[model samples]
Target: MLQNLSSPSLQPSSASPSPFTHHSSQNYSHAKPWPLQKRPLTRLSCASSGPKRKMVPQSEKLEAEQLVRSIMWNMNGKEPVLKTLNKYVRVVRTEHCFLLFEELGKNDKWLQCLEVFRWMQKQRWYVADNGVYSKLISVMGKKGQIRMAMWLFSEMRNSGCRPDTSVYNALITAHLHSQDKAKALGKALGYFEKMKGIEWCKPNTVTYNILLRAFAQARNVEQVDALFKDLHESIVSPDIYTYNGLMDAYGKNGMIREMESVLSRMKSNQCKPDIITFNLLIDSYGKKQEFDKMEQVFKSLLRSKEKPTLATFNSMIINYGKARLREKAENIFQKMKNMGYTPSFITCESLIMMYGLCDCVSRARDIFDGMVQSGKEMKVSTLNAMLDVYCMNGLPMEADMLFKSAKGLGIVPNSSTYKLLYKAYTKANMKELLQNLLEHMDRDGIVPNKRFFLEALGAFQSLPAGMETATATTVVGSPLGRSKT
Candidate 1:
């Protein structure tokens, strides 16, 4: 028989005695022969009561998240993550184990999730249930581990757990994560067709939502239309997520007219648009460079009860920057700050690039410097932005200086860094600097491919005839000649 690891017998006993326990032998007959004075009973009055402490209950999800974080941080012993997990598993409730598996799955620790699931199966409390298999399949599907998800389905059936609608839904989602998009869609359709014949496994709203969203993402208009037709024929009512998912997918693919049609359908169904719906519309319009439509959506969002998120401002700032509307981008950045949204790394990177593209190099430098002083971990993108700006503005000398300081600042130069510097040096016709860069590239193991040679030749061809031949031969030969046999 499987052991009950989390049983009360396995847990540690409490050290302290209960306060409610009575000492029966103690006498209290003459302890309080009180005075009969008529005093106002202040303690009994409602006004005299102290403020009640607000007890915010900890949810299972929060507890699971915390447990996963704790395990990840403290698993220092010479054992696998699963083994370390076993020690703690013996003390927590079964529900907590399920939650931990979910947390691990979300963090892409699929192997560890499998270990926990297997451990649960060995416990006496575990029974063959469709929910466990359904959830596990969903997790595996999310990580694109379709083979493992299929194996789980086979194992679930062997354990006498019959497949339900939720389980079928999980299987369809797993197929959607497959690398072959056409094959995945075909399998999903096959499952949908199979589900129709099984009375107990009739497709639910969730099933329809999944297939619709998948088809919309693939931009399979024909399949999306057919699915909608099937959905209308069914008794299941489509929820807000169903519409929202379709709209978001369509908007991402730049199908604005189709997205608007979905919005109209939503309104007709009496389903109110949520914050996500507005964010999607705003982002789509902005990406299409339709500023007027974007602004109209922004105004409508402001008027509606749904508050704007940081994503709302981020999308607007990035798109305006792309459109070269410097003033508008800056205005949106300022609006985000006024609304108490702290600038994230993405926010800083976007602003820096925007300012650089607009020839406002000084403003970009100020933002970079501010970020440095604030002690936030600088990302490579930030450094690359500054370097690109210097090169773009005919300040390669300044860019070289920045490159030298990068190592001291703990910022590592990537391939993009080398590419930018090489182009800059080649343009300036700094032969000695170009040679040094080649040596550095060789040391860093970044091999000069055909594309690199083509760019180098193009840059050299721009020079006078005599200089061009000599410089091109010298530059191309240096890296190849210096390479270790």
Candidate 2:
């Protein structure tokens, strides 16, 4: 017979129910803790002095219940509640009230999440669970709070809750999301083995897939191949997710032949490709400019009776735009509308990019205007595409306007965006715009690439008054040099 996991000795037929699982739904009874007697809300920390805030009381269970209801009313999403709760939380100690904290943690409220975690520790009803700690760890990971995530993982163990496979997976994924790839990969591998060490908490297919993705992202092709061999050697079977990860990695690394072989292996394994699989293949072919192969994959996806998703159309349009295949890309856009799939932010971004690439500035502007009219949020890529199109067609003023619009809309321009605007000003010899954009990039912490440096050098060379060239290459073994912008 399968044993009840919560309690081993309590048999289903003959034994009394365990107390842990016996919390009655009707009896909401608890002796009030001393903290609940004073204020209804506890104030933990105060930052900007605007108004006095209250924390949910620790003692009054009913008060905590009402407070939760009020907090829930104030919260439309995690961000708002997190901001409000950060100033408040010290008074509330009820387990039910911890829902606010957990939600905040799940939603990337890193600091508030820690405050709640600490608050839970001080509460009498706080029974540490692997689930709670794992959640906190995942939140911290997502928010780039790696140190905090590790601390919570260790705290879970110290609190007598054993880390399970799920907890390890969370940790691995967190590290993987960090900006430092080498360190993240090393950390993920460490957790992978730690999960494997426990007899009951062995690494599963999901665990391997996460690691496989990490290795692939790091471009460790040798590790990817070894993982496949190890999977075949072990009892674990590779699934669709595994194949998709490998194909994506191979495609990204421009290893088209290896990607095809992996597709063949997927077929031999009888793992029917899903939408994501088809999207990967199409995107890969498109990136390689193998449009014929890309079209073939698109046709196969359509014929397979699996409906094409937004990602499918977005990939096609973006690749076609990049290749300057304007007509065919537009046809796909029309077909998507005909198929009843509404254009998303990505779809609009692709179309703007496509028209921009084809030098159809008016058409790109039309799409941008439509996006605004429909109240669709504009992405930085869309703004960048528009800016690039304007600059390419000798419309610097229009480019400047779009750049200002991006700033006004609170959209920070990336390196590519700044690069386009910089080139525009360079062509027109507009020193102010040119200097300003470089400063903007610096302010935004976006590192200018070789492309930016090269463009600036070209601008300096194109100066009318004098050429920035070496006056003499050899003069008594002293080579001449010129300064570039």
For candidate 1, list the clashing residue pairs, or say none. none
For each candidate in turn, the TM-score is 0.71, 0.69
Please give the lDDT score for candidate 1. 0.71
Task: State the lDDT of candidate 2 residue by residue for 5-75, as single tens digits.
Answer: 11223111222221111111111101111122222234332111112335544565567667766665566
Tens digits of per-residue lDDT, candidate 1, 246-321, equal 8888988999888887877776666666666677878888989999988887777666555667778878887887
Please give the CA lDDT of all the candidate structures. 0.71, 0.66
Instruction: After superposing candidate 2 on the true structure, give the runs of residues whose Cα lies further than 4 Å from its correct spot.
Output: 1-108, 178-180, 375-381, 392-394, 405-429, 435-485
Taking all chains together, the TM-score of candidate 1 against the true structure is 0.71
In model 1, what is the error at residue 295, expressed in angstroms? 0.6
Number of backbone collisions per candidate: 0, 6
Predicted candidate 2, C-alpha RMSD: 13.5
